[model samples]
Target: MRWSRHPRCVSLARAELRTALAGWGLLVLEEAAVLVLSELLTNAGQHARVSPGREIETRFRPVGDGVRIEVHDASTVLPEERRPEYDECGGRGLILVDALTDCWGYGERSGPGKMVWAELRAGSG
Candidate 1:
């Protein structure tokens, strides 16, 4: 689904993802999936420089024994994993993603944007 580049989009995406995973009988990955989705959507809302008329696109699909989540934005800038200082309040999104997901990466979209994606293996917990 397409989401506005606003902070609320993270919760919206999480709700949709939770519903979808429940419907698919993949609740085993629900928590991790929601967290990863939140990070991806948060990055889109904060970093993507799309026009006012554009929006971030999020997709969820079943892949093998897990689910793949992707967030598409209008910016080509890829996300960087930063080593935040000890007292930092933020900048750990990707770090959490790395620890939670089976794998994660970003790639250029066909047109003018990039797609950041992560996969959560069901029953991995």
Candidate 2:
């Protein structure tokens, strides 16, 4: 779905997650999905290419007992889970996401943009 950077977007995301969790009954999975969404949205708003009249897109899908959260940005440059030194303050978003999720990766979307996705199990799988 499409959403602006406004505060309401966060609420919408949270609600979507809550509904998903209700069906899957996994607290950890829900939290991880929310975290991945927040990280991807923040990254898109901060790092992804943005021109006039552009908005970020996000989609959530359940694959087996795990959920996949995909964030699409207008830029082709994929996000990397780089492990920076302890002194550095930035560049830890993807790393934290990678550490939290069961699996994550980046790939090209239907258009010229890219999709960064994180998958976390709904339970102990």
Candidate 3:
């Protein structure tokens, strides 16, 4: 599913994750799913620089051995994890996502903008 970068979209992603797991015995992964959503949503809002009325898109797909979550935003800039200052109190969200996800990265889209993606192992089931 895709969503606008609007703030409420974060909650919508969470709800979809919950519904997907309903009675599927995948509930245990809810926190991880939510964390992934939070990090990607924050990235979309912070870096997408999408103008008002423009939209950011998200998609979830079943990969070969896992599930892949991707966030597509209007910005072409790829995400990079930079070390923040010791006194910095923010900007570590992607670091956390990297640690939790089996693999994660960003790539430029064919036409315009970029897509950031993360994957969780399926055998984890």
Candidate 4:
């Protein structure tokens, strides 16, 4: 599904992800999957420097006993992983994503920009 580059899109995307996970009987992965999606979507909305009106896109797929969440944006800039100091107010998105997901990464997508993806394995529990 397509989304605007607004922060509000995060909750909408999470709702869509929950629906998909429920449909696939993968609600067991809901919490982790939602966090992963939120981080990726938030990163895209905040960092992707594309032309005005360009939007972000998302995809949710059942992968084995888990779910794969993807966030796509029109900017080619990739997400950076930062080690923020304790007093920092932000910048830990990818760190949480890495800890929670079985694996995650980003790559060039078709049209423009890149697709940041994460896979959650139900077995993680």
Better of 1 and 2 by lDDT: 1
Clashing pairs in 1: none
Q: Using alpha carbons, what is the TM-score of model 1?
A: 0.95
Residue-wise lDDT of candidate 2 within 61-107, one digit each (tens)? 78888888888878877787777899998889988887788888889
Ranking by TM-score: 4, 1, 2, 3
Looking at candidate 4, the ten consecutive residues that score lowest on lDDT are 62-71
Predictions: Cα RMSD each: 1.0, 2.2, 2.4, 0.8
lDDT of 2: 0.78
lDDT of 4 by residue, 1-125 (tens): 99998888899989999999999998888888998899999889889989988889999898888888888899888888999999999999999999999999999889988999999998885
TM-score of each: 0.95, 0.84, 0.83, 0.97
Q: Residue-wise lDDT of candidate 3 within 1-125, one digit each (tens)? A: 77776788889887876676554456666688778978898779777886776677777765555567788887877788877898998888888888878888988865578888988775663
| Least accurate 10 contiguous residues by lDDT in model 3 | 20-29
Predicted structure 1: lDDT:
0.91
The TM-score of candidate 2 is 0.84
Residue 11's lDDT within candidate 4 is 99
Candidate 3: C-alpha RMSD after superposition: 2.4
Error of 4 at 106 (Å): 0.6
